[model samples]
Target: METIQREMTVFARRARASAGRMHPELSLVSYTLLGHLEERGGCRATDLAAHYALDKSTVSRQVAALERTGLIERLLDPEDHRVQVLQLTDAGRQLLLQVTDSRRAAFKERLADWPEEDLRRFADYLTRYNGWTPPAAG
Candidate 1:
C-alpha cells in the first residue's frame, strides 16, 4: 500500500507538471478560487476566504490580480456599502470554460483504461477524504 501510494504521488506530480505546461501562467489556487465563485455565481471576499479556509490577504491578492486582468470585478455591495462582492466577467467565464474543457480532456486521457467502477471508487474515496481533511495551505 505504501508503494502504491508513493507511485500515485509521483504520477500525480508529473500530471500536474504536464498540465502546468499545457496551461501556462494559470495558478491552480487562482483557478480553484475562481471555480468556487463560478459555482456560487458570486460571493463575498470574506465569505469566500472563510469557505476555502484561506487567509483573507491571500484571497484578496488573488482577487486583485483577477480584477487587474479584467477577469473579475469587485462590485460594491448594494445592501451594504462596506462589503465587497466578487463576480466573474465575460472573459473570466470564457477562460473558465476553456480550462474546464482542458481538464476533462486531460483526465480522460489519463484514465482511458480505467473502468467506470474504478473511476467511481476513486472519486468516492477522494470525496470521503476531502470531507475530513483540512484545506491545503496557501
Candidate 2:
C-alpha cells in the first residue's frame, strides 16, 4: 500500500509538471475542469464542486478564471431558469484537443518499449484502481 501511494504521488506530480509545460496558463485543476465541462456538455458550478469533492469557492475561482480567459462561458440551464451551467467555448475545445494530443503522444513515446501484454495489464490495473470507491462517512 505504501509503495502504491508513493508511486501514485510521483505519477501525479510528473503528470502535473508535463501538463504545465504543455500549457503555461492552465493548472491541472483547470485542465481537468475543462475536460469535465466538455464531457458533460454543460453543468452547474455546484455540480462540478460536488463531482470533484472540491470546495465551492475553489471551483468558483477556477470557473471565474476560465470565464475571464474565454475558455468557458455560463449559460442559462434550459431545465432550470435559476441555474447557470458552464460550457466550453470553441477556443476551449480546440485547446483541449491540442493538450490531449500532446499528452497522448508523450504517453506513447514513454511506453514505446513496453510489451503489449504489459501495457494491457497496466491499463487494466489502472481501471480497477480508479473504479474503487472509499466507504461513505458515517
Candidate 3:
C-alpha cells in the first residue's frame, strides 16, 4: 500500500511538472482525454463520458478546449450522423508523441540507477494496474 501510494505521488508530481511547463491550459483530464483519442482513433462524446464516468457537459467543455487548440477534430459519424466522432488532429498526434517522449526521457533519467529487477517488477505491477475489465458496452 505504501509503495503504491508513493508511486502514485511520484507520478502525479512528474505529470504536474510536465503539464505546468507545457501549458497553463493543460490538466490531468486533458492529458487523459488526449491519450484516449490517440489510442482509439475517433470516439463519441457519449462513449468518452461513459468511459470516464464524467458528466457530458464537462467532457463537452474539455473537447471544446481541445478543438480550439486544434488538438482534436469533431466530426459527424458517417454511419450515424447523430453521433460525433472525436479524433485527434495531426497537431494533436504530434503533441501526444512529444509529450510521451518527454515523459519517457524524464522517467528514464530518474530510474537510471534502479536495478533491472526493480524496473521489471515495477513495469509488471503497472501493467496489472492498468488492466481493467470494462462493463458491457451499452
Candidate 4:
C-alpha cells in the first residue's frame, strides 16, 4: 500500500510537470476544468466545484481567469434564465484540442516500448483506481 501511494505521488508529480511542458499557459487544474466543461457541454461554476470536490472560491477564481483569457465564457442557461453556465470559447476548444494532441503524442512515445499486455493491464488498473471513492468519515 505504501509502495502504491509513493508511486501514485510520483505519477501525479510527473503529470503536473508534463502539463507545463504541454502548454505553458495552461496549469493542470485549468486543463482539468476545461476538459470537464468540454465533456459536460458546459455547466455552472458551482457544479464544477461540487463535481471536483473543490472549494467554490477556487472554482470561481479559475472561471474568472479563463474568462479573462477568452478561453471560456458564461452563457445564460436556456432552462433557467437566472443561471449562467460556463462554456469553452472557440479559442478554448482549439487550444484544448492542441494540448490534448500533444499529450496523447507524448504518452504514445513514452509507452512505445511497453508490451501490449502490459499496456492493457495498466489501462485497466488506472480505470479501476480512478473509479474508487473513499468511505464517508464518521
Provide TM-scores for the models: 0.84, 0.95, 0.80, 0.95
Residue 125 error, candidate 4, Å = 0.7
lDDT of 3 by residue, 111-132 (tens): 9999999999999988987786
- Would you give me the overall lDDT of model 2? 0.94
TM-score of predicted structure 1: 0.84
Which regions of candidate 3 deviate over 4 angstroms?
A: 1-10, 132-138
Off by over 4 Å in 2: none
lDDT of 4 by residue, 1-138 (tens): 999999999999999999999999888999999999999999999999999999999999999999999999999999999999999999999999999999999999999999999999999999999989989999
Report residue 118 deviation for candidate 3 (angstroms): 1.0
CA lDDT of each candidate? 0.84, 0.94, 0.86, 0.96
Q: Quote the RMSD, in angstroms, for model 1.
A: 3.6
Model 1: per-residue lDDT, tens digit, 1-138? 999799879977875776576567557767787788899988898988898889999999998888888888888889999987899999889888888898888889999999999999999987986689666789
TM-score, model 3 to reference: 0.80
- Error in Å for residue 61 of model 4: 1.0
Sliding window of 10 residues with minimal summed lDDT for model 2: 95-104
Give the count of colliding residue pairs in each prediction.
0, 0, 0, 0
Error of 4 at 68 (Å): 0.7
Highest lDDT: which candidate?
4
What count of clashes does model 1 give?
0
